[model samples]
Target: MISLPLFSLLTDVAVLAQHGPSDVLITGLTLDSREAGPGIAFCALRGTATDGHKFIEIAVGQGLAAVICEEFPATMNPATAYVLVKDSAEALAHMASAFHGHPSRQLQLVGITGTNGKTTCVTLLHKLLRELGYHAGLLSTVQNQIDEEVIPATHTTPDAIRLNALLARMVAAGCTHACMEVSSHAVAQHRVTGLRFVGGVFTNLTHDHLDYHGTFDNYLKAKKGFFDALPKTAFAITNADDKRGPVMLQNTAARRETYSLRGAATFRARLIANEVHGLHLEIDGREILFRLIGVFNAYNLLAVYGAAVLLGEDPMEVLTILSGLTTAPGRFEPVVSEKQRVTGIIDYAHTPDALENVLQTLHEIRQPSQQIITVVGCGGNRDAAKRPIMANLAARLSNKVILTADNPRFEDPLEILAQMQAGVTAPDAAKVQTVADRREAIRTAVALAGPDDIVLVVGKGHENYQEIRGVKAPFDDKLILTEIFAELNK
Candidate 1:
């Protein structure tokens, strides 16, 4: 889609020599050899499972004009052009930026990083920005959007090449600002390298992703990379209430702004009341109302407000925009039915902290006579340490806990449930029931709930597929909940 001077713009000379420059043109850029084309440039990035070096020959034979790789092959054709670098991934990021004309530098880029709340904060910020009349591009765990076009995203943070390409498209589409969820894996992999961020937001860090990073300390270090890479003019907005928030502030060089629901912060939320509809709070001494339930959401709102203010938006205007927003897909999304008076909320709370927060929030809002019921499960082959923790919180906070399967990738669902059940110390372990089928589990939980009771379907928020032994089956909690609601109403 973008035309550039092929001969003059090609940085990897080894690629140019073999291909011969004839009206030099690169139609597209890709890292995977399978996706490469005659005119495309293949970036040979080294990954954990496979080395891109092994695929360089395939890329070259497929008519790729150049190969950007970390090391050059001795058997490589002298005519083939190769750009060798210490880190091919980082080089790919820079090349992608160059190829895209550095689109991020032209727009106001807001990046949010943390163990939790990254998706919620980015989604809320995108909505708030659009409501304020700014054409905003959003990239998160749920989806990627530029203007009206929606692209399915496989990772929370996309590769640098794709990221830069998306930003360029957003700019061409007349977008002025962009919000992105910066995941720890992306940071560790340097997928976001060579991009300039205008503002950085930190939600909170908790135990997760230990499989990839190996330890909590490593995870924290990977997350800190984003703040360390921010531009000098960037503003750092942090959740002062989180124990790790202050540590992030100490690590960043950017101008710092803090928000919290506890103690002192640049922007603070004081909860006046909590109800089924949402929360009533005073933000920075100003009365603001939100339709999002739970104290945790109040913290999320405060972070958004702090980031918006740092971007020069009015405080009251931010509140007004947020008031019109109801719920993010899969994130505490409520499903209502006239016949079934029970309240159903779908949330993406897989980790112990997230599960605890959601359950505790719902517990706080439950009527004295009403019971709290939760359906939750852990993803197979992930951080198994969190399984018992999540179970403990679920049993402790709710009257009933339905243990079900969630992304049982190559692992037995019953085995996963047993691990989680190990943490429930309650005498009423009978309250915990195991259902490997997620849909059936949800149905059973909802069916057991009374009109006054609250049912929470946790994990897999905004996700549409359920992974079982490496195959993704079509499944969505929201769609199922909508169908159940319609049936109950009818």
Candidate 2:
């Protein structure tokens, strides 16, 4: 609904390429050429799988107001309007922010980025801030929220146009704060370009998105780019326990702060007791009990506490308020069936580091007689490098391990399972089994459990659908566990 002269947006970085009507009022913006129309600007970007530049001719044929691309497509018509920018994706971000009235500047926006705890940190921020009597907005992989409105999310970080638009809606709804998850893919591709963040939190970095970044250095660079671009006014809070956590803020101009459990830090926490029920932590100087369990939750709690303090909340009040809040959904969500005394934990740990963290946490708290059974899988079309590592970790850490499909996508489910099975060594081979069908995998895990056993279903937590061959079917791990447990008891 924002209308401005075409030249007003194009005058700075764009060069006219066979211009038609430079003063035409623009009404919409998009990066995909398929969405281009008479009054919309099409931003053609070079993506991982394909380049948006190839669809320029078809977009121009549809009479788009302007086609913003890198080289001004090879076949340019004299009557067709075109605006050439140095980088189409980056330009789209700035343009989209402008079109949305720069809502990020209106509210205090905090970006939480890292490999494991981005979702939990942001989710805690939104829920905590709202409970403390402030209107807050959330943009996370689990879902998107504008004050009280909930919207389904298709990506961890949405495209630039949708991202700005969502922020603008939050501003319009009178939101005073916004918490978002900044993915490496989004940062590398400049999806968060031109958005002002008041603060940025680094959870931790690990082996998750190697398929797109292609290398560890490239992945690290992409994460550091967010901190590097941060303004001096913004505060950078990081985990001092992670070796690379301090490295994340090394080049940033932002005021740096650290949070840790391993040693003394600007904001410090000590894990008093890590039980399945909750965690007892000594935060700053005061002892408090929190309902979130595990060492990973300890990191998440510290990050949330640090971020809340930087955002100008009272130190004690933040801890006191946080102590009552439960852990985010499907993150080590524990359930018990009435048939017998057994614990079934549903978590979203998929990466090697994340899986190891969860398994080690279990190893720390599990009783002498309590056994561990794990059902985990790597997603199709994702970091194939982690499949074997995840398999090996599950086999090594659990008394029983079931290899299953998380989301097969386009790859054959059995093929993905076979690749995972290759990681099981001779000693671990007797403990591992392949159940390509995820539901059956869950059922088998539940059936194999004893009175004092725990079944940890990792990967695809909080997700309600199973994606296979580009189609998403209904599948919920928590629901399946409850159904299986109930059916067996009946």
**Strongest candidate by lDDT:** 2
What would the TM-score be for candidate 2 when compared with the true structure? 0.97
| lDDT, residue 309, model 2 | 93
Residue 21: error of model 2 in Å? Answer: 3.1
Error of 1 at 64 (Å): 1.6
* Residue 261 in model 2: lDDT: 96
Write the residue-wise lDDT of candidate 2 on 1-490 in tens digits.
6887776665434453534556677899988778888888888999988999889988888888887888866677675567777888888888888888889999999999999999999999998899889999999998999877999888999999999999999999999999999999999988999999999999999987888899999999999999998999999999999989999999999999999999878999988999867899999989999988888999999999999999999998899889998877788888788667888999999899999999999998899799899999989998898888899999999999989999989988888888898888999999999888999999889888899799999998899999999999999999999888888778
How high is the CA lDDT of each candidate model?
Answer: 0.84, 0.89
lDDT of 1 by residue, 134-223 (tens): 999999999999865799989899988888989999999999999999999999887888888999999999999998899999998898
Per-prediction TM-score to the true structure, in the order listed:
0.94, 0.97
- lDDT of model 1 at residue 381? 84
